[model samples]
Target: MKTLTIFTPAYNRAYCLGKCYESLLRQTNQEFIWLIIDDGSTDETGKLVDSWVKEQKIEIQYYYQENQGMHGAHNKAYQLIETDLNMCIDSDDYLADGAVEKIIHFWQKNGNKDVSGIIGLDADQHQRVIGTRMPAQIKRSTLFNLYNKYGVTGDKKLVYRTELTNKYPYPIFQDEKYVGLAFKYYKLDQEYEMLLLDEVLCHVEYLEDGSTHNMINQYRKNPKGFAFYRKELMKLPYAGQLFKFRQAIHFVSSSLMMRNQYFLKESPKKGLTLLAIPFGLLLYVYILFKSRTVKHV
Candidate 1:
């Protein structure tokens, strides 16, 4: 069995998938398998992957499912991964040099049943670290504390224990495709801390169609998914009042977008949701405006 499975949830990204495949080929260690969850891509993605499978340079597993946004693809990936450890490298991204070797060495030395997984850095194409680096002194921290308490920023690569990840499967809402991936990570935070690795594991490029760039559209198109994510965050016992309030505000806005008559009833923090109504109304208006602008462009 491989020590790690690098899964890519791709949707119509055939042009750039090659870069990710080539990066895997360059790995100093081939101890990981590449798992591609084809989330109903309509392009030449399937053909391209088939060619790679024929080359047989490394282990690859590919599965195709009806379109289900990023989080839905994640749900499928978690179901299929049998490796002891796993990590997600976006379709528009690739692994850094020696990344496989680094993950293997670090896990062998520090990995145990107690830790959820390893948290590593993600760099840009020019090798600049995204957001901020993990604090050097901290060896183990929950994903939430790494940001909320210690102030680590930017995009980071998470390599999770497959067993642990499977325990918190991301929920799939019908007709919605944009649940926050952190839903599962935050759940894991309740039980285990991840070991921090300062080395860069993945290099990312934010294509225009990528989720991060089109969040406003996501907000409008997937209000129920957003509402569910915010409600989950609000229920986190470790979350501070301010964080919960922020989630409440967004929850209210999404609920409104959904035209859900039970907004207040469904809220985890009804008092906070009531107080945030005005701000949420403003957010709803802004989403409408922004979505209109996107359509015009």
Candidate 2:
């Protein structure tokens, strides 16, 4: 069995998928499988992947499903991955040179059942680290604490044990396509800490169509998903009052957008949600205003 599955969730990204494929082709180690979860791409992605599959430079698996947004694709990837370890490299992102080799070697040296898997850094296309590096003194951390406690910023590449990832499936809401991916990670943090690797494993490029660039529109269009994510965050034991309140504010705004009558009743922290009404109302109006001008590609 392969030691790792580097999965990519692509949607109408045929133009950029070749760069991702080229990076995988250049991997120094072939101990990993490339799994592509095609989230309803109408482009030539299927044909491109088929051609690459025939070349057989590395193991490749492809699955095509209805467009379910990034989080939905993540759910599908986690369910399909049977490898010992797995990592998500976005369609616009690619693995660093020798990244697979580094991951396998680090895991063999320190991987254990007590931990979920490894957490590594992500670099930009210019090869600059995107955020702060893991502290030298800390060798392990829960995904939540790493950012909340240590003040780490920006996105990091997470390699998870396939078995553990399967246990926490991201919730799929009807007519909603976005959810905080941290929903599953925070739940896992309750049970296991992940080993931290200082190595950079993936190179990221945020395109115009990427989710990060269209969050305001996402908040407006995916209110239910946002509300559900906020409710989940509110229930987290490790989450501080400020964090929970912030989630509550978003929850209220999203609930308003959805016009859910039982917003208060459904909230884990009803009192906080009630207290956040004014701020949430303002945010709701802001989202509406911003979304009107924003074009979701």
Candidate 3:
């Protein structure tokens, strides 16, 4: 069995997925399986993967589902992954030249049950590290602390254990197609600290057509999903008061958007949510104003 499963949750990205496929073929270590979750794309993505599957140049398992947003695709991927280790390489992203070799080599030498998985670097197409490299001094830490406590910034690559990833499933809200991916990571942070691998694993591209708030629109539309995600963060034992307050602020904003009168009662941090209400209202208003501005522009 392969040591790593590289899963891509694709939604109508047939145009760019070829690059990801080509990169996997270029891997220095061919010891990984590629799983593609086809999230109800009305594109030629399926036919494209079918052609590649016939070539047998690499292992590819493709599954199609009704459009479930990113988190829904993630839910399906976790269920289907058979490997002990897994990583999400976005449809618009691809592995670095020797990413598979680096991941397997480092994991085999250092991986254990106590650790969730490895946190690696992500670079752009130009090969510049996305945000900041992992702190060399810290050998292990939760994904939350890596950003909140250690001041690590930008996007990084995450390779998680299949067992742990499966434990926290992102809930599907009615008519809502989006949820923050960090929902699962923070849940796992409660029990595990990931091993740090400062090597670049995947290269990412942020397409202009990808988001709503910038995907800000995602928040305006998926209020239930956003409110649920923020409330969960408020309950994290490892997070700071300030962080929780910030989450509360967003929670209130999303809840108000939800038009759910029982938001305060449903909140995990009631007092904080109360304090955040005024600010949340302001944010809610700003989102409305900006959304109109976008439509006009």
Q: Who wins the TM-score comparison?
A: 1
Candidate order by lDDT, decreasing, is 1, 2, 3
TM-score list, all predictions: 0.99, 0.98, 0.98
lDDT of each: 0.95, 0.93, 0.92
Instruction: Tell me the tens digit of each residue's lDDT in model 2 across 61-179.
Output: 99999999899999999989989999999999988999999999999999999999999999999999998999888999999999999888879999999999987678788888998
**Candidate 1 residues 1-297, lDDT tens each?**
889999999999999999999999999999999999999999999999999999999999999999999988999999999999999999999999999999999999999999999999999999999999989888899999999999999989999999988876777888888899999999999999999999999999999999988999999999999999999999999999999999999998999999997999988899999998999999999999999999899
The local lDDT score (0 to 100) that residue 199 gets in candidate 2 is 92
Model 3 residue runs over 4 Å out of place are none
Q: What is the per-residue lDDT of model 3 for residues 1-297, given as tens digits with 9 covering 90 to 100?
A: 988899999999999999999999999899999999999999999999999999999999999999999999999999999998999999988999999999999999999999999999999999899999989899999998999889999888999999889898999988989999999999999999999999999998998667522566787889999988999999998888999999999998898888989999998888999999999999999988887787787
Who is ahead in lDDT, 1 or 3?
1
RMSD of 2: 1.2
